[model samples]
Target: MKIISNKGGKELKLSFRKVLGVAFIIAALICIYFAFLQQEKYIQGNAEYKKIKQTATDTPSDDSKHTQDFQVDWNTLKTQNPDIVGWIRMDPSVNYPIVQTKNNSYYLKHGFGKSYNINGCIFMHADNKSDWSDPNTIVYGHNMINGSMFGNNKLYKSKSYTEAHPYFYVYTPSGKMTYTIFDVMTVNDATVPYTIDMQTKEDFQSYLDTIKKLSTYQMNVPVTTDDHIVTLSTCTNHGRQRFLIQGVLTNIENNNRVGGGD
Candidate 1:
């Protein structure tokens, strides 16, 4: 009887081990399945954006007058989604249509096609004028792991990256604007303030000084209260911190195609 009982206990232990092994395998399979689904979602979102880019944007010819002139067909593009305010491009990595809504949260989950997507489209701050006339226009994007959106934004923290890609272009409905990157920094979201209403020169100058001091490297790019700057913002670590790339408007080429929010 003792021998039979010992044998039964051994069988139970083996059965328990089998159960755990099966559970582990099942869990792993579920994880892979979800990961695959996420990857597929990103691919689909990217395809949608690529279609928009090819359909509505083109490279400027040699005769183009502006250094940063990239032709954008705002008329046709807006028909697809009127929220599109402009096109933001940083060669070899970042290029996407910029969108602005009444609030900033919509584009954080939606694409240019207004479809639900994890890799949301690039967007302007809610308070920013869609015309890009603000003293400091702020742009926001998700730090996608796949290097889409503003995922490469953090790379600007490296002086070498900025040296290689010194400027980024924004094609507004009215013109193509060139912005020279001056500073890149990361700050606690709560510690530093972000504002679109720098009504006074002193206020704006103070804002500029704060960011310049926070910058990780000195590029000696002259920026002052008079300059119209663009701040490209993205998350660093789950939104607790924020990474910013500040660029001062160096040049503007008016194409006379006027269309944007007030």
Candidate 2:
């Protein structure tokens, strides 16, 4: 009887331990599912929020509604961002502002929250060139979310997409400017000419040569040492390559009424 009692007690304890283990496993699975759901919700919310905020800007409103006071034509891009030269507009346009960041921290900092794409995202330099004034300004963004960021970057690869959307409207903070898309290139990240070698005439010339050699755009712009430019960089090929589109400052003369083109 004693032996039987001991054996039964041992069996009961083992069964209890097994039940607790199963409960733990079930709880862990539930937590993982909720985490996934939350992440999806966050991304969706971010896309939606940006759209809504842009509606407020798109609607005609008082001049004071703008971040700056320089715009006469409310629709003008110059009035939008004093530092912004032009914006990238897409087919399935987000109906919102293409976000601008002042640092790489936006993604890591959750500046865009769930809307942020870790695969590719926007980054900026506080003192780097602005689209309007600099002969060559560099604005960096990413492509991921299965190429949504730079994935559509491949859109430029299509000759038809290039022909259909030949002109990308650029509005500089200095004033509204137009950038005739003249160059597109997929380059190694090591060729970091845009970020470096801006200090001297020699450096700038080398930078220009590198781009000219690699440009996929058939048409060419007359870029002089005096000319300012804009460089849009995004990650491609899983961060191994950089998809870059460069634009020259063209016809800046049309943007004077807003006191731009400085």
Clashes of each: 0, 14
Give one digit per residue, the lDDT tens place, for model 2 in 1-262. Answer: 3543588889999999999999999999999999887677557645653543354233323321222233333243334433232334333221123334565445432323334434333434444643345546666655544334334656776656765655543433345555555678888774754654377777777777878888766554577677766666777655577777776666553553332211
Candidates' lDDT values, in order? 0.80, 0.53
The RMSD (Cα, Å) of candidate 1 is 4.5
* TM-score, cand. 2 vs. native: 0.60
Candidate 2 regions exceeding 4 Å error are 1-42, 48-56, 59-102, 107-109, 112-121, 130-132, 146-151, 172-174, 253-262
- Global fold similarity of model 1 (TM-score): 0.89
lDDT for each residue of candidate 1 in 73-123, tens digit (9 for 90 to 100): 888889999988888877446778899999888889898888898889899
- How many times do residue backbones clash in model 1? 0
Off by over 4 Å in 1: 1-5, 59-69, 190-193, 256-262
Cα misplacement distance, residue 9 of candidate 2 (Å): 31
